[model samples]
Target: LPAEKMAYLRSLQQKNKRVGMAGDGVNDAPALSQADVSFAMSTGTDVAIETADVTLLHGDISKISYCLSAAKITMNVIRQNLFWAFFYNIIAIPLAAGVFYPIWHISLNPMIAGIAMSLSSVTVVTNSLRLRMLIK
Candidate 1:
């Protein structure tokens, strides 16, 4: 069994950039340990549990899809946060530093800055919460 498993892993490694194995039995222990990421059922054998990197808390395999969706939403929120942070800093910093003062003496008020910062945080949190809607 180990020999066949190793052969399949080798073949998979050759054809895929990344491969993961999920199993819930003692017989699957070695293969689970050998894969890039192993997902073990909460009710799996001790050996399977010990060999896996991720253990499903409720033993529901469907949670894997939910997890992936949440991850995608989290990543998107992070990207949006970064974009907004960079955009605000690039524009606001220069303006607040008086870069435009020579022409119009314009600058962001401290109260406005505080409001904008709070709004940005709210936006990120709201975006992250959208993941709940994605779950089936």
Candidate 2:
């Protein structure tokens, strides 16, 4: 298709929809530039590859789904890690400070608190490592 038509199609699609363009021609550069997510074949024209958001190394369309899936998984892991870190600190900080000493006599020893803090960091790192298995 002509570059003009491609650009027009991109404009129409962008009004209320996300546009994803995949093309290997120099003519596709304009549309690719305007797309929300543009994918280009590594074997395609230089212009197309340079304009695209992602370049498929083997020029395989299936990799796009895999890329998107991995991105979602990575984002989930980040959120989980953030939640774990914050939750651990929230519960551990007060206990370490002896906030419950007046009524329930609950407190964390300094040495144990240090170990627990280290363990919480390990938990976050371990959770992030789970992504390798999931993506594979």
* Cα lDDT of model 2 by residue, 30-78, tens digit: 8888877889999999999999999999799889889888888999999
- Relative to the true structure, candidate 1 reaches a TM of 0.68
TM-score of each: 0.68, 0.74
User: Highest lDDT: which candidate?
Assistant: 2
> Which candidate number has the best TM-score?
2
In candidate 1 the C-alpha lDDT for residue 78 amounts to: 76
RMSD of 2: 3.0
lDDT of each: 0.78, 0.88
Q: What's the distance in Å from true for residue 75, model 2?
A: 1.8
Expressed as tens digits, the lDDT of each residue in 49-79 for candidate 1 is 9998888887889776666666677777779
- Looking at candidate 1, the ten consecutive residues that score lowest on lDDT are 127-136
**Model 1 global lDDT (CA atoms, 0 to 1):** 0.78
